[model samples]
Structure formats: structure tokens, C-alpha cells
Target: MGLERVIPVAEKLGVTRPEAKVLTVAGTNGKGSTTTTLAAILAAQGYQVGLYQSPHIYRFNERVKINGIEVDDQVLVEAFVRVDQARRDCQLSLSFFEATSLAAFLIFQQQQCDVWVLEVGLGGRLDVVNVIDPDVAVITNIGIDHVEWIGDTIEKIAFEKAGIIRPNIPVIFAGQQALPKAIQDKAQACQATLYAVNRDYFYQDADDGQHWNFASSGSTLRLPLGHLALDNIAAAIAAIQVSGLDVSEQALVTGIRNARLAGRFDVRQIAGKTVIFDAGHNPHGVEFLLKNLQKFMKNHDQYTEILSIFSMLGDKDINSVVKLLKGCILKWKIAELNVPRAASLAELNSALHTENNVEQFENIKAAFESALAEVKDNQIILVCGSFHTLEAIWECLEEWQ
Candidate 1:
């Protein structure tokens, strides 16, 4: 509902304003990766760090982590108990996101974390995580997803994300797209120093394509490549730099090399086949996935067939994303996800638009099994579309193991 509902419970739980340094990340994409990298770097610097992210791939414990380790079930259960009691005393109802976020705050507060890295679950201004004012607010990128909840235009979405900016704080805009005026105006109104990517800070591939360089007016760091995207890594570094935190160069490099998020461009060798799992359901995210896929292909042997296990939520822009990916995907194994917003077979077929290299399955496990059985030595199977799509396959793999 409103921030008022969660704020009171958070205050009652003694987590409304954490004593630790807060770095809040918000965007249409890259929020999870950026937050993960930030926490990893701070932890590498020997700080007690707490990280909170959303839409976990496998387990609920993945939502709350300390020192790069997912907290145990007992920790979450304890925090949830506290939050539930507080909410009951306040007589307020919370959505799953709001309740879990407050629980994360309670855990971080109890652990006495040195740094709190929070990922905004949705639009920034109204998100439960925004209850704590961030010392460094990072907007990884803005895209036209979540239009039904946020807005239909990029500017409108930017305005909602800009709600995370606070007075006299450092704001990092790392979106590759043009800088939205709404963000600039909000930064000005708040008197926050804005470090827009490609303007205040820059990143490029070094002489060796394997490594990259990040340069700002304050410092320059040559970093090793990691599992996440370079832009997100750079954004995390910039936020740390502006945060006035004491992070060593070694910590920066080591953390960059060590940081990993499960479903973003995740690769695995399963059943003698090359499989990639990504949670890119929107056009912008899919575009990023394609670029990384192209790079992977360039560095490795070409696959004779690129088969995709695809599904999407009904709210997403399925047509644009399908068209953007059609050029690279040779065949598609579409399945209907068992979620309230999942797309129907008819809707998926409409998006396909005469692409005959397609097969429909009743569920994700069957589609994945068919892909595994049919994939040959020279074939690559891509599991994508939504987080739900990847989560289904991951759960199935766990069961089989």
C-alpha cells in the first residue's frame, strides 16, 4: 500500500534508519548484480556487509545475505517472527515484498552491519527499501518494463526511480540510454551530486579484451572481468567511490573478480551440453544478454544450433523482445509458466509471428527435458524469458541431482 504502513513497522523494529552506511540501488535491470557487487567489494574490504535483493532464483534465503553468504533459514525465520509481531502490533498488512524487506532490515540491524546494500524491489520512491535514506543512491538503468505498475514512458519510469535520490547524496545514473530530464531535475531539486555514466565516469575494454578499466576524476582502476556485466560493475565501483567509504584497490579488484549473481548470464555444462541461464524478460535486458552471447560465441566454437527455452509474463512486452531475439535464436521451445501473470500459448504464438522453428510444451520441465534430449554436441541451449523460467529449470536440476 503506502510507505506509511511499512515505515511504522520498520521503526518499531528499530530498523527505520540504520546506523550503517546505506547504498540503495534501483533500476529496471542490473539492480541485483550491482547490489551484489557492491556488497562483495565492501566485504572484501573487511567490512561487515548486508545485502538484500529480490526474485531469488532458487531459495528464499537468497533474498538476504551477510558477508556474501546467504543467511541460514533460522536467521530468516527469527527475523520474520519479529517483523510479524511488529506488524501485528501496528495492525497493518504488508505485501510479500514489504514484509521480507523489513525482515532484512531487522537482520542487518541485529548483525550491526557496517554497510547496507539494498536493491529496490520496484519503483524506488514507494518501495519499502526506500524507508532508509541512502548515502549513495544508484540507478543502474531505466527501461520500459513494468509499465502497468510504473508508467508507459521512459521519462515517467525515470521519475519513479529518481524518487530514491536524497538531499546532498551522490546519485549514479548508469543507464546506457540517454539521460532522462526527470532524473536531472530531481537531482537538482535535491542538490544531490549526480555522476551520470559516460559523463562523470567512464569504462572501456583495456588493451586486452579480457580486462577493463574504470576511470573517474578521483581514481582509475584496471579490473579483471567477472561473471556480471561491465557496466554494472563500473556503476558499483562509482557508487563506492562517491560513498566516501574506505575501500582498498585490492578489495575492488578481488571483489570484481569474485562477484557473481546466479541467473544473470549464468553458464553451466549439464548433461554434456552447453547451457546458459539468464533472467532477461524485457527488451533492454534481452539486448544485453544478446551482446554477451555474441561475445561468448566469438571466444568459443560456433554452435550449429541455438535453441532457446523461452517463456514470459503476460505483462511484459513480448512482441518487441521476441523480435529482438529472433535473429540469433534458431529454434524455440516455449512453455507456459505456472504463475498468475504467465503468458498463454496463443499469446506466445502471436509474438512468434510465423517462426515455424518452435515447439510448445505444457510445462517448463517438459520443455527443458526435450531441449536436453534433442540438443547435440554442437548445439547450445539457452534458458531465458523470465526468472520463473530459469527457476523452474534450476529446481528440476536440483531434484534430479
Candidate 2:
């Protein structure tokens, strides 16, 4: 839960501070999207960029990338060997995440990347990503997630997320709610100038919906929308603007257009059905998912019924998530995920007790198969609830491919 275990190993591995400009992003929901977009923008400006994110969708190689491409297997293996030897020399025990993160840092340093954009795998203050001081820090948003490890309330979580702030650096808080006192206090103590969304910078969808605008005190630019949510893209843009990096406006446009994240409203035509794969497990995340789903239904009015293939981790707020989607989702096809913290069938059933059109299956694959078999031309199938759920479906669909 703290960096005490990783710092010594990082120092031994010589990745405590690499020779590269660093930007660290911490939050519950949008860390992946924000980091991906930030890396894309840096790469668009012709900088060699290294992006490190967590909880890969389909492959472990997805966690580390160079200039928008996943690093090769041999590179990762060599880095792992070095990281293992370093930890052994330090007489320290590194968790799986700690070892993998150190390896990613080693790869970035060895490649001599111009910039490194790191995403916090959990709450920020004690995360391994905090081992290196970032030139710019961005907090995408804070929510009541990972309560066991972080905290139970918004303020508590905010305090942990604010741990990434450093003295004299630009800190960006992009939460839609009012800035938490803990974050404000931490930033003030660090003497870091904090730029909050809506207060210091703002983003709004343009009238055409095909483009959006980002405006701060000094500059304004209208850019094309990407596959990700607008708020996340806006946060990435704000981080880059305050980063003081030599990035042109065209690079921003090109990066925004090229940035794509899997399982964040990822749309695909699979098995003769329009399926949307989203990794929204908490209430805050589900709210964003609902917003996107509503807009999609509005544009494609032909989709009358929405069928969902959903499963979640046991520790999540299942009832609230179900409440959010039950109204829009006409039918639910649920199963227990094959993960350690997966919610059992009893838990999912108890949460969905009020719903009438519920269908149970053996596993996530069967649930997805049922949804696809029953989906019609006018209906959409949504695979969501957890990243594991999406992984299960992707693995199953790989055979069809």
C-alpha cells in the first residue's frame, strides 16, 4: 500500500529518475485514456514517447508502449530479467505490479525516450508510479473505488490521488465536482500551482458535435473528437498545455484524432451484432457510460432494445451499477466472472432482483453468446461491468476471427 517496498528496488535498478520528461496521471476512471492521449500528443510532436498503463485488456505487452506501438516480447523479457536481477541484489521482494512497473521504467530508460507518461495503477500517494517525480501531474477524477486500499470517501481518495503533486510543478485537477480540500491543501503545501477544470481551463462540445473546443486563459483551439470521452481528452490537452512542451496545434489535432482506447466505449461489429465493450465498473464510471450510450441511441435511433452482457468484481457497488443501466438496458445476461474477486451468481442475482428480464448463464462467454444469439437488427449488445468481462468476450471472439 506504500512505496517503501518499491523505492529501494527502483533506486537499485537505476530507474528512480530516468533521463526523460515525465507526466504522471492519477485517478479512478480516466487514467488509461488520459495517459494514452497524452502519450499520443507527445508522439505526434515527433518526440520518442513511452507510455505505461495498467490492467491490460488482451495482452501483457499492452501495458508498455513506444510511440503508440506495443513493445516487442523480447524487449519486455530482457527488461524483466534485468529487473529480477536488480531486485535480487537489493534483497527485496517485489509484487507482480511492482516488478512489471520497474521493468517498464527500465525499458523506457534504455530506449532513451524523450517523454514518459505514467498511469497510476491504484491510488497515487503510495503507488510505484510516484517513485519518479513528474514534470507535470494530472488527476483525471476521483471516485469511491478501491476503497479497501485507498479509502471510502471522496476526500480520502482525493488525498491519495494528490500524492503525485510535487513542488513548483503544474498540477491539474479535472474532477467535475468541486476540488476536494485535501487536494487543495496538498497542492498549496507543495507550492504547486493547481489548474482545475472549469475554473482554470474549460472544454465544451462544439455545435457540430464532430469537433470540440478547449480554452484556457491564453489559448483556444477547436479539435476533432476521438474515440474516447471528451472530458478525458480535455484533461490530456490541459496537461500538455501546462507541460510547457514544444507541441504545435496540428499535433494536438492529429493526436486527438489518433488516440484510441480499448474497452472505453469500444464499438465493434461482432457475430452479426453491434457490441459496445466498456470497462465501467463503479457508479461514477457507469454514469459516464450511460451518457455515451444515451448519445449513441439518440444518433442511431434504430436501436430500440439494448441487451447487456454484464459481470463485476465482488467488491464493487453492484446494486448502484445495475440501477444505472437497468432503465436503458432492456435485458441483462449475467454470469460469474472467472476471477479471484468475481461476484458470485447469488450476488449478481440479489443486486438484479428488481429486474424482470434477467437471464443467467454459465459464464461470461455463454452470456455473451446468448446476447448475440438473441440480438436483432434494432438492438445493441453491450459487454461491460469489468475489464475481465471484456477480456472473456475478446478471448471467445478470437476463435471466430
Best by TM-score: 2
lDDT of 2 at 190: 96
Per-residue CA lDDT of model 2 for 230-311, tens digit only, reads: 8899999999988889999999998998999999999898866799999999998999899999899999999988999999
**TM-scores of the models, in the order given:** 0.98, 0.99
How well does model 2 score by local distance difference test?
0.93
Measured by lDDT, the strongest candidate is 2
lDDT of 1 by residue, 1-401 (tens): 35989988988888877889999999999998899999999999999999999988899999999999999999999999999999999999888999999989899999999999999999898889899999999999999888878889999999999999999999999999899999999999999999999999999999988789999998888888888998999999999999999999999988988899998989898776899999998998998899999988878876656899999999899999899899988889998999999999989989997798999998999998998888877789999999999988998785444
**What C-alpha lDDT do the candidate models reach, one value each?**
0.92, 0.93
Inter-residue clash pairs, candidate 1 = none
Query: Which stretches in model 1 have alpha-carbon errors above 4 Å?
Result: 399-401
